[model samples]
Structures are given as structure tokens and as C-alpha cells.
Target: MSVKNLLHSSKHSSKHSSKHSSKHSEDILVGVGLRHPHFTDILTSAKEIDFVEVHSENFFGQGGAALSVLQQVRETYPVSLHSTSMGLGSFADIPAHYLARLKRLTQTIDPFLMSEHACFTWGHLQGQLMHSGDLLPIAHTHNNLKRMCEQVDRVQTYLGRELIIENVSAYVQFDESYLSEAEFLTALCQQTGAKILLDINNIAVNSLNFEGGDIEKSVVDYINVLPIDSVAQIHLAGCSDVPHGQLVVDDHACPVSDDVWQGYRQALTRFGAVPTLVEWDSDLPAWSTLIGEAQKARDIANAVLGVNARASVMEINHE
Candidate 1:
């Protein structure tokens, strides 16, 4: 059977319950990044959010107002911990103390999922350990892939759970890279069992920066190349056009773009329903706006998956 048909059949047979209970459990989960501006509203409103993702570094401190807020949020919704500084692709080993701290946080939060970037943020410079405070792309070569696998293995071993690594948006390409981004990620998953947090927006952005023809097709090709089962989550966000309209920056400051929405649809068709998050970090909007974007994603996913599920059932009955 085709993937769509299989997904449709699985949805009806699956025993898992949706957050709303009224919605299909197999429908893709749609959520927004929990930012400080929307905390009060999220804590008080009667919104129907499937989940919320937070930067793991935000609540790493032992005791703080942020932790208190997260504790309260954890009480009501499923949480995904996204780490910005784990530097999984860095040549330098992740600090033992830092991993220990994250382990403690995991013990406390018991998050439903955890993720970090495929890019490195820390490296040795002039015999000193320096943090770039940015998601720097790594060369897509065999050696770098091996190093990344080692880093992911260390993190998963410490947490006793699989880690999802997100692909980073890059404007520049390295000459030393021997593999495409998709190939590197696929190899990483095969070697270390790490899953992918496929960021559709990033793919769109990189397509615009690197290749200019048929952005949607590029995204579809990228998703097709990935190991389908290795994808654990999906991220949707907005990008900004450069002054000259020559580059698209992954700023995450606006609503989902049309090209991105198209890419997301293709992803659903290829990967089926995955836990998808709507990320809007900069130029934060009202809480309702963020929720609205998530609702839009939910609608699109449901419409696509619902049709496939129904079609699959009809085929089975006819057979």
C-alpha cells in the first residue's frame, strides 16, 4: 500500500488519544514555541494547544521564575525540550557538567521529547574554549558525521532517550563537504540512532539561498531523501527576505510563508503526521496570533491526513 493509505489505516487502528479527544489521534500535533510574552495568556487561557516546545537552556537553572513558570506549564501540557547550546556537532566534547545539569532538568521535567541542533556552537579558538552563541554549520563530511554521532551518542546515553537533531539554515557551503545535508543526517541516524527534527522553514530558506528554482520541489526532494522513520518532529516558521531579495533569512519573526506551507504539505504526504511545532521567536505576536498559526497548521494537516485515512478505509472495504 502507499504511505498515505497505510497512514490512514493506522490512524483508525491506533489506540492513542488526541489532546482534545475530539480530534483524531493520528492527526499531526500543532503547537507554538512558548515565549515569555505569551506565558501569562497560555497559563490562563482555555486554549487547545497540542503541546509546547521550550529552549532547554531557559530552564536549566536550579531555581528561578522561569523554572517556576515551566513547572506550572508542565502541569497542563506535554512539553518538548529543545536545546540551543548542546553543540552536538562541535569538535569539542560537550562538557560533562553541562550534560549532568541537563540530566537533572530531564529528571525534573520528564519532557515528552528532546532535541538539539546539528550545528556546532562551541569550539576551541587560540587554545581557549569559546562559544559562538550561534548555530554554525558543520562541514558535511565523513569525519564530521562521525564526530556528530559521537556527540549524539553521549547525549542519548546520558538521558537514556533518543535525541532529535535539527538541521541548521546556512547561507554558505563548505568545499570540504563530501555529502549533502540529507546524506549526512541519514548517516548520522544510521550510526547513532538519532532522529531528525525536520525544519521545513529552514529547508525553504536554504533553498532560496543556495538554489533558486522551484523551492517547493527542493523541499520535497530533501524530505524524500531522509529516512522517513528517522523523522520524529517537524518545525514550521517564517523567514525574512533580504534587502536585495537575493537571500531568505530564517528569522522566525513572521507567519508561515506560502512556500513553506506547500513544503509542509509535501512533508505530510511523505512522512505522514508527525509532532509539528510552530516557531515564532522574534517580533513576538499576541498569544492568540501564535495559537491561530498553530490552528492553521492543524487544519491543513487534518484536511490532508483525514482525506487519506478515509480513502484508505474505502479501499480496504472495496477489497
Candidate 2:
């Protein structure tokens, strides 16, 4: 069998399929990010996905259609909360109101897991709210890691659940760094007891943009460095081709590339099957199309894990 065919077959094969079957099908849930454009379509389809994930900052409002739809969706499928604006690794203090809102949503939605980027999304040097509009990187120095650990502790404490930290797509390299991104994230999970929400696309983006190294090798290296068990879930997103450059930008504007699908399958091989998400943030597709794309993630997870078409753990356990 071809490598790609082997990956697909091993993922969705039966009990007699492969040697690795320790992780259950329930652990291989599929989900998509909640965006304004896809809200109605997601709400419309009742049998579409295993769960849904939303950006914490987007639902920071008191009352709106977004919250209402979220409330309705939670009744049907599990929801995973992902935040881009928390800035947990930043030097700035945590936003009081944002935390409260996130806390409230967690209570209301009862999400299975909540995650945020390892990079700080907020920055205020001297009292002004200087929004970076991007997931800003933190100094990897020991002192910086200490500061970041405290912030992560605070967020998990407030939320009363383990917060999974995702590695961001970094565009620039740092000079005063102490640990590699892998080491720093592994340490964060070790010290703070928070799990990791590994984004395969971000690793690829960072690898191309900054490292200028082999993408597949980079993925394997990062996975090898991380504690395999802490990989609670995985994220796959589309990226854009950089202007006049070979590296692709981590823009969630395109479809999941074949490179990323290969990475996902590799992740399943290394980490075993976990809840994987398809994140398409911009130029949203139709609801059915988005769900179809999400199914691709599910298919990859199922194929790698050696489950059947039903792919439902509840069904697997019953048998």
C-alpha cells in the first residue's frame, strides 16, 4: 500500500487492523471553530459534528445571537473553548473582565476542554492597551517562563478546569530565548498541570517562516519533545502563500493542504488518536462544506486510529 493509503486504512480499519489500539474512538472527536459566518449553518445541522469550538473573546458579550446559538449548540454537541486574546504568556496582567466572561461561558457551555495560544495575545507596556492583533511571543528566558506559569495558573484557577496551551505561529526569531518552544511548552504543561492543544498548522508555519527547515521533520521533532499524553487535542487550519516568498503564512483563509493532512496522520501515529479540529477562520465555506471538511479531520483520525466508518466510540464500546 502507498504511504497515504496505509495512513488512511490504518486510521479507519477494524479490530484486526493494527498494533496500536490503546486509545478509544471516543478520544477521537472532531470539531470546528465557531465563527460568525458559519454560526447559522452549524446551528442548522443537528448531526454534523462531534463538537464545536469558539474563540473566547468573540463571546465576551453579555447577551446576543452568538451566545444564544452557542447555548443551543451546547445542548446537542460538546463545545471546546479556544481563546486568541487571553495573552497568558505576556508580561501584562490578565484582563479581569475577560476572565469573568470566559468563566461565565465555561459555566454555561460546560465545554469539554478550553485552550489558548502559548503566545500572549495582548500587550500593554505602560498602561495603554496596545493590542498586538496577533499572538505575540514571550521571551523564552527562565524568568519569562516563571511569569507565564503564574499566568497560566491564574487562568486555570479561575476557570476551574485544565487550560490547554497551543503553540503559536511565530514570524520572527528571538535572541534572548532560554528554551526551545517545545521545551518551554512541555515545561508549562509539567509545572502548571495544563494540557497542550497542539496546532499542526502553526508548527508548520513557524517551521517554514522562521526555522527554514524541513516541515515533516520539524513536526516529528516537536511531537517527540512533547509529553505524548499532554497532547489532549490537535488543530488543523488553512494557510496562505506568502507574497514573493516561499514560506506560507499561517492565514486560515485556504483549505487544509495535503502537507497538513500528512502531518495530521503523522500526529495520530505519534500521539495516537485525539480530538482533532479543522479551523477555517476566513473566507468561510457553506455549512455543509465546512462540516464535510471537519469530517476529513475525523476521517484522518479514524483512519490513523484504525476505526470503522461509524467512528463513534460509544458504538465501538458497545460492540
Whose lDDT is greatest here? 1
Error of 1 at 129 (Å): 0.6
lDDT of 1 by residue, 7-106 (tens): 1212211321232232343556777899888889989999688789999888889998888899899898878889999899999988888888898898
Worst 10 residues of 2 by lDDT: 1-10
State the C-alpha lDDT per candidate: 0.79, 0.76
Q: How many residue pairs clash in each candidate?
A: 0, 7
Residue pairs of candidate 2 with colliding backbone atoms:
10-303, 11-302, 11-303, 11-304, 11-306, 12-303, 87-121
CA-only RMSD, every prediction: 6.4, 9.4
Estimate the lDDT of model 2. 0.76
> Who wins the TM-score comparison?
1
Cα displacement (angstroms), candidate 2, residue 95, comes to 2.2
